[model samples]
Target: MVFQCQRDSWARQFATRVVSCRAAELRPEGGGEPVRGFQPDDRGLIGDVPVLRVTRRGPEAVHFVQAALEPGAEVLLSLDWERRFDHMQQHSGQHLITAIAEQMFGFKTTSWELGRQRSVIELDTPSMTAEQVEALERSVNEKIRERVPVMVRELAADDPEIETVRSRGLPDDHAGPVRVVDIEGIDSNMCCGTHVSNLSDLQVIKLLGTEKGKKNKINLVFLAGNRVLKSVEQSHSTEKALTSLLKNGPGEHVEAVKRLQSSVKLLQKNNLNLLRDIAVLIARDFKSKPVQSQLFVLHRKEGDSEFMNIIANEIGTETRRALVILEQDPSLCPQETLLFLTVGDEKEAGLFLLAGPVEAVENLGPRVAELLGGKGAGKRGRFQGKATKMSRRGEVQALLQEFVSHGSPEA
Candidate 1:
């Protein structure tokens, strides 16, 4: 059975008598457990009460209401005209594009979607060239300009004329006559969606371009009617914002951004070289000490992993009794601190370069990490990981001191 929406797409206000009213659970389109009394704010009104949603149950139009009503109550059902018109424009535009593509280029449309902001039609082709898209858009708008009539014909289920029109197939529960929408001298297809009466009602169509689809198909995206105008306005606003920020015209925005990127890359390269030099100096100062402490700790607010590794490699070559811990200051990263730990000793620094006591490192590394609210792993006397609580660095330092004094983490 054809619903009122399908029969008359232009109808904004519908007057009808309620057949029945009952309380029931309704599941949202985005599948979930059934909800009771789901009142959506954007729904239309049934007389004084809001219509939560409307769905098709078998051949009947089921209206989900927020409140109970008498079985024979007379109600005025009003449609959100703006939204309905948008849907009509997109739906009709899809039909036009599908017909033209199939007629002109043999690119048959497999399916289509009338999206909230824009619409898409899936063509059974591996890819679509920019030239083809341009041609299709031109032909579609030409038809709209000509103001071609869109006619709807209801045919008997067993009618021989049904075989002449394009159709996917009838639903398993579908009954009664078949509805075919025809674009004059263009194409005819079986459809149940609401659409405009004339091609001119589509206003204009803007082909946004194409996207790769599954199973060797191309999804062509487009904006119809008011959507095309809105898209142009949005693009112009974005261009103006970019022009102000880049201090360049819209045509030069891309070039200006490229130049800025190049400058940033050069500055980053210079910064890394300076950081390396600083790492070398820091290591040299520690090694120059006549009598070095058994443990060396350093924290730098701006140091990265590369800088930390450089310092570790430099100081690691000569110190046999020292254990070094480097921390990337956690102030900038309130939730986590990057830590690097290395034990250096000339005796153990052989082919594998085993830096210090393996037992001491294995025992202290994990314990230190735990106290700082994190986990770590290491081998050959080197450990590193991220810690959540850098404020407990003092506790980690104390643990390191104990390990150094007793030559074992347990002490």
Candidate 2:
């Protein structure tokens, strides 16, 4: 977990020699055009002291490299050790992983990134197999264990060694020395990010997974050093929870879950058959007893709507019996309930309305639905609707009772 940081700069008070200049005095470097109102690289404070660090060379007039310091002004310069170390470990691990993939499987690393928690390398290949990932994990960790030296050198653009290195490309305004990193005998590539001095400093490299990326490429997700340990801890906790819930060992949880799902399905089927039978019995008893005008059953609970519909259908076929089934609103609204109405008279032969008059039942669904604060639709004397206001159930029931008794819903 050793960290090596090269890019981080600390603001220290440097000797200042102020000089006046004009716009025309600016000189662009590497033959680039001059820009106006430029900014310096770094800024910090120490008591009454203000310091600026020059990070890059630019036009002489617009960019000032130094700031005047009052006599006896104290200065402070510090580095974020944890941040520096994390960046080094991830960046160095990336170069090693990229090199191993390219050398072993011919899967070229098109690009890579050093994220906050994890890093990813985009490969030129469209997809990767489980076996390929395993192979990569094995080869990369092997190099980490070997602890190869990482050498950085600034090479001239025309140098012979430059031709042997793998590089993304130089910047468009290139004019300086090309800095290249060499992972001993494994890889040598041009990079600007900070990195560890040796493969052993990375501790380990773990390839978590891969996903299909844009333009038919593959992205390899990975974690290095302490991050790998954190992921392992979190995954272990989740497995323990799943094992306890399933009442089985981690290896047998999948089969245990499958068995539970199958049992649930069987129970649901049996419950539905029993409800249908109960509906038949209720309808038959009502036919024999012949209650006043209509046989309306209201249950205030979840799962009663299906039973209501079945019972209504059974009651619809009996002589002189019209059905109005309502279930209480699960949402706790008294005026809003579910209604299932079917006015069928199968015993009436050709008329089909003698058992429960069709004219009386035809328009009842719409009015009942309106009282229930919703709309409904039906044909051939069967309909279902929602009542937005379950409190209005009395009005709906009264209307249905009138229709069943006097052969007119309005009556």
Candidate 3:
């Protein structure tokens, strides 16, 4: 059936009589079970109610109204002009690009999507070159400038002229005659989507480039009419922002950003070296103490796994007599805190190594981790993982001290 939307794409308002009204079960917001007869309003006249959507149900054009209505009520349907116009521009633009691409490069369009922001057409080619894209855009816009007429023809399903037009076949539930959209001197295809009456209505088309698709296909992206202008405005705004931040012209933005990234990398390498040196010194200071404590705890505002490992290596076999816990500042990461706990006297230590009394180290390591709202695992004497409540660090410290003095964290 040729609906009003397809017959006259330019129509903004439609007046129709409701043949039937029934409660429908619609999917609820955020998606769960469908809600039956979810009426947001009471029964009303045509002008008081609004049509939410109009779709084809079998051979009938169904209107999903926002309010309850009798079987024979008349309603005035108002089209969202802006949205409808956008669809028209993009749908017609797709036809132009699809036709020109096949004509120039023999890249037939397999399918296309009229996306909310932009439109994409999948061509039956493995790839598309920049030169081909440029040529396609030029040819499409040229036809638009020439103001080519777009006509629609409805013929019987067995019409002889149907063989001359491009078609992907009709749907199983399709009824009535076949509708073909013809672009004069360009191409003709069987379609049911709304389209502009003239190529000029597309205003202009900008080929945004291509991306790889399934089965060795290429999807070409594009924008038409007001979308092109909007895209240009957004791109210019971004360029201006980049120019201001980089203190360079738009042409130099790439080089400026590359140099900045190189400088950041160098600074990070130097910072890591300095952190390693600091870790060594901290380990040496604890080892050199006249009377060594049983527990050694150190917290740094900024350090990663590498920094913690350096300190553990410097401690060496000292872990046999002391339990060391290294932690990043809890306040720095209020959500989750990183921790490294090692209790071993081995010369070469792995992460979270435990070399103390089998029972003491095993019990203390995991228990302390639990106190900080986290979980950890260790074989000899090492425990490491993230904690959600590092604010309970004091309790974990006390537990460690008790374990060192009494041979058990619980005691």
lDDT tens digits, residues 1-411, model 1? 877788888888877877776667788778988768632222257777767677766676777776776777677878878888998899889989988999888998898888888888999999989999999999999999999999888889899999999889888888778999999999898988888999999999999999998799999999999999899999999999999999989999999999999999999999989989998898789778775566766656555666767776787665332322223433322211122342222122201111234566666777777776666677866666666666666677777777666765554
Candidate 3 residues lying further than 4 Å off, grouped into runs, are 20-56, 60-70, 290-301, 320-411
Tens-place lDDT digits, model 3, residues 1-411: 788777888887767776677777666456798645423221122455654545566567665555566656666666778888898899999999999999999999999998889889999999999999999899899999999999988989999999999999988899998999999989899988889999999999999999998798999999999899999999999999999999889999999999999999999999989988998898788678766566667656556666766776676546433332224343332111112343322222222322234466566667666666656676644456555565666676677666666665564
Error of 1 at 235 (Å): 0.5
Model 2 ranges with Cα > 4 A deviation: 1-80, 156-163, 173-177, 263-411
Model 3, backbone clash pairs (residues 3+ apart or across chains), number: 6
How displaced is residue 62 in candidate 2, in Å? 17
Local error of candidate 3 at residue 105 (angstroms): 0.9
User: What is the C-alpha lDDT profile of model 2 across 74-166, one tens digit per residue?
Assistant: 334333456657778888888998998988889999888788888999999988899999999999999889989987777777898888789
Highest-scoring model, TM-score: 3
TM-score of 2: 0.52
Clashes of each: 1, 9, 6
The TM-scores of all predictions, comma-separated, are 0.75, 0.52, 0.77
